[model samples]
Target: MKVLVTGAAGFIGFYVSKVLLEKGHEVVGLDNVNDYYTADLKYDRLNELGISKKEAEIFKRKSVSSKYSSFAFIRMDLEDRTHLPSLFENESFDAVCNLAAQAGVRYSLENPEAYVDSNMVGFLNILECCRNHKIKHLVYASSSSVYGLNEKIPFSAEDNVDHPISLYAATKKSNELMAHTYSHLFQLPTTGLRFFTVYGPWGRPDMAMFLFTDAIVNNRPIKVFNYGNMERDFTYIDDITEGVVRVIEKPINDRLNEKEYYKLYNIGNNNSVKLSDFINEIENNLEKKAEKQMLPIQPGDVERTWADVNGLIRDYGYSPDTPIKEGVKNFIDWYRSYYKI
Candidate 1:
């Protein structure tokens, strides 16, 4: 199968692209390579997939990597509807996994426009392309943040997600609604995966795992948000990749009895870990006690998050079993190696 994976330079997207290439599938990766984090880190992720910094810098449409014969990359943004359509028309992608978006929930509070442009306008372009190109299925990245103040311990896709706490969460929830519209109007098959606390090697710098690891290794103070009362389903990257691959292979199809080919699933570890416990794993793995600065939870931050992935397990045999200790160890090892720490 020929697959188009947006956010190819991103953490999850890069891993997913590599796996797909290894499986002998043709993959065309697209990413804007924005500086939400360091562009160097994004470039390094591309480098792992055999894309050169020189090639990435020039906004190349198609760069064939030396390592993966089945892999190609395009430096493009989802908001650029003109180029997006042209690419879709030219490549004729079989399936698309949309992971490109302005991601940070906290950052969204500061820069709301970025979220609107990337998450809202950007997603519409994807839907339009999928609809026009007759793509078989479109799998997109939603967020557990969409469950926002629901007071539900384990969030389900069936639950109403109308009260998103941040602009980021609002946009994520909006994506689900837009996907359903496309699925209904054009009979396009779409699936949205609400990811929860995804972390591992090559993880985003803004996330807690990366932040805490960096601070601990550098002998800097790590900010303990919500006074260390926070809880999260710190899902491992491998588990997320597996769930994504499974969903991609099995495209949702609207039956005579069903309304449309639209579905959503929570891709996360069911086990929730307290903030202190998580930090303990990181500290133990790094052999360094982190200097902690207790802080009140920032706005747009949720007290806790847990995912209900039973639907995923039943439908596609999805199971996330990576322990935090193991995941943190892998991350710490990668961090040390990557930074020469």
Candidate 2:
């Protein structure tokens, strides 16, 4: 199958693109490569997929991978309706994994417009392109953050996500809504995978795991939000890619008849681990104690997030079960090797 993976340079998207290529699928990658964190890390991820940094830095110029004949990448934003339409017409992608978005939750408080442009406007363009191009499947990333302040134990797709605490969560919920509109009216097969706290090797620098490890290694104090009372269903990168692939390949769920082809599932570890325990794992792997600075939870932050992944397991015959210890060790090893620490 031919697949177009948006946000191909991102942590999760990078792994997903590689796995698709390994499975003998033709892949076209796309990302604006904005410096939300740092464009250097984004380029490095592309480098791993056999695309040169020189080749990917240029905007709108599609470059075929130096290593993988089945893979190619383009530096472009999703909100570019003019070019996005043409790209869809030219590629005629069989499926699209729309992982591109403005990303950070707390950052949304700083720049709410970024979330609207990338998550809302950009997503609308994806729907229009998929609808016009008649793409078979549109598998996109959603977030567990949509659950917001709900007291729900294991966040389920069926749970009400109408009240989001942050702009980022609101945008993700809006994506699911927008996808549902397309799926219902156009019969497009759309699936929204609400990802939990995904962490592993090649992870994003802005994410908690990376921040904690980096601060610990540098002997800087690590912030313990909610005073270390938080919990997260931290999933590994490989598990996320596997689940994404399954959703991209599998047929529409039973909920979809001729009426609506929309599906939503929580992609998570199905188990929550306390923040203190997670930090402890990092400390164990690095063999260095962290100078913890306990602080109140920041705004737009939830104390805990646990995804109810029964729907995913029932539909995909898969579950994310990588032990926290193993995942942390893999990440620590990569961090050390990548940084020469």
Candidate 3:
């Protein structure tokens, strides 16, 4: 199968591309390589996939991977109206895994326009291209944050996500709605996976795990939001990628006769770990105590997030189960080597 994976330079995207290549699928990875956090980290991830920083700089130029012949990459944005359609027409991809989006929830508060451009306008381009090209399957990244302000203990796919606390969550929820429109009208098989607190090696620098680890290593005080009363269903990157691959390969075929081929699932570790416990795992891995600074929860932040992944398990026959301790150890080892700290 030929697959087009958007945001292939990102943490989860890079891992997913690797898995798809291992499965002998010809993959064309795409990314704009924006500097929302660190462009160097994004380039380094591309380097791991055998795409040189030099080749990645050229816009829309497909760079074949030095290691994997089946894997290639293109530096481009999802919102490119002209180029995106051309690429779809040329490549005629069998499936598309749209993981590209402006990610941080808090960052959306500062730069809401970024979210509108990438998550909203950009996603519309993807849907248009997929619909025009008649792509078989379209699997996209959603977020657990969409279940904002809901008092539900375990967030489920069926739960009402109409009220989102953050702009980022609202955009993600909109993506689901937009995808459903295409799925129903054009018979496109679309699946949205609402990811939980995803963390592991090659993780984003803005995330809690990376921030806390970096601050702890440098002897800086780490902020404990919500005064250390937060819990998250932190899912590992490998597990997330595996579930994505499964969904991409197996599209929604149950409702082929009815043209109701849209679905959503929560991809996360079913167990929710307390914030203090998660910090303890990081401290254990780094062998350094963190100077904690308890603070009130920032705006656009949720008190806790717990994913009910039964829908994913029932449909894909897979669930994220990486223990927090093991995931933290892997991340710390990678961080030390990457930073030489």
Candidate 4:
């Protein structure tokens, strides 16, 4: 299978591409290499995949590694509406995993336009390209934040997600709606995965796990939002990559006689962990006490997030097996090795 993976330089994208290559699938990686957090980290991820910075900067196609001859990388952005169309027309991708978007919920509050451009407009472009190119399947990254303030214990794909608290969540919800439209109108098979608090090694720097780990290792104070009352279904990256591969392997097929081919699922750890407990695990792994600064929750921040992955398990056998302690230990190990902490 020839797979087009957007945001290939990102944490999840890098992991996903690596797994796909391991499965002997041809993967074409696309990313703008934006400096949202740190482009160096992005490049380092690409470097792990055997793409050099010099070659990546030259705007020419590059191979993944010496062994993975089927893998390639391209320097492209989703917002490049003109060139993006050409890419699909040329590559004729068998399927697309759309993970490129303005990621941070808090960052959305600061830069609303970025969200509009990447999450909304850019996603629209992907839908258009998928529809026009007649791609077999399209799997996109949605968010658990879409279930804003729903008071639901474990968020389900069937839950009402119309009322989103943050602009980022609203955009993710809007993406589901747009995807349904394309699926209904053009018979495009689409699946949206509403990811929970995804955390692990090579994770985003803006996320809590990375931030807290950096702060603790550097003796900086870690801010406990919502007075440490928050709870999250912190998911490991390996589990997420597994779920994604399963979905990619089994494309939804509701077109023959069914009314709709669009579907959504929550990809997350079924168990929710308290914020303080997560911090404790990190502290325990690092063998360092964290200097805590309790503060009110910032805007666009949710009090809690949990995922009901029953549907995922039933459909794709997606079960998160990594415990929080083990996940934290892996992340701490990576942090220590990456930063020599």
What is the RMSD of candidate 2? 1.1
Using Cα atoms with residue i matched to residue i, what is each candidate's TM-score against the true structure? 0.98, 0.98, 0.98, 0.97
* Candidate 1 clashing pairs, residues 3+ apart or interchain: none
Off by over 4 Å in 2: 253-258
Q: For candidate 2, lDDT tens digit of each residue in 1-341?
A: 99999999999899999999999999999999998988888999999999999999888889999889999999999999889999999998999999999999999999999999999999999999999999989999999999998898988888998889999999999999999999888999999999999999989988999999999989899998889899999999999999999888766654456566888999999999999899999999888999999999999999999989889877778989999999999999999999887
Count the clashes in each prediction.
0, 0, 0, 0
| Cα distance off (Å), candidate 2, residue 113 | 0.8
Candidate 3 per-residue lDDT, tens place, 1-341, comes to 89999999998999999999999899999999999999999999999999999999999898999989998999999989999999999998999999999999999999999999999999999999999999999999999999999898898899999999999999999999999999989988899999999999999999999999999988899999999999999999989999999998875675344556899999999988999999999998888899999999999889888999888877777888899888999999999999987
lDDT of 4 by residue, 1-341 (tens): 89999999999999999999999888999888888898888988888888888756655354555546887888876888888999898898999999998898898888999999999999999999999999999999999999998987888889988789999999999999999999999999999999999999999999999999999988999999999999999999999999998898785763224656888999999988999999999999988899999999999888988899988888876688789999999999998888876
Candidates' C-alpha lDDT:
0.91, 0.92, 0.93, 0.89
List candidate 1 segments past 4 Å from native.
Answer: 254-259
What is the alpha-carbon lDDT for the whole of candidate 2? 0.92
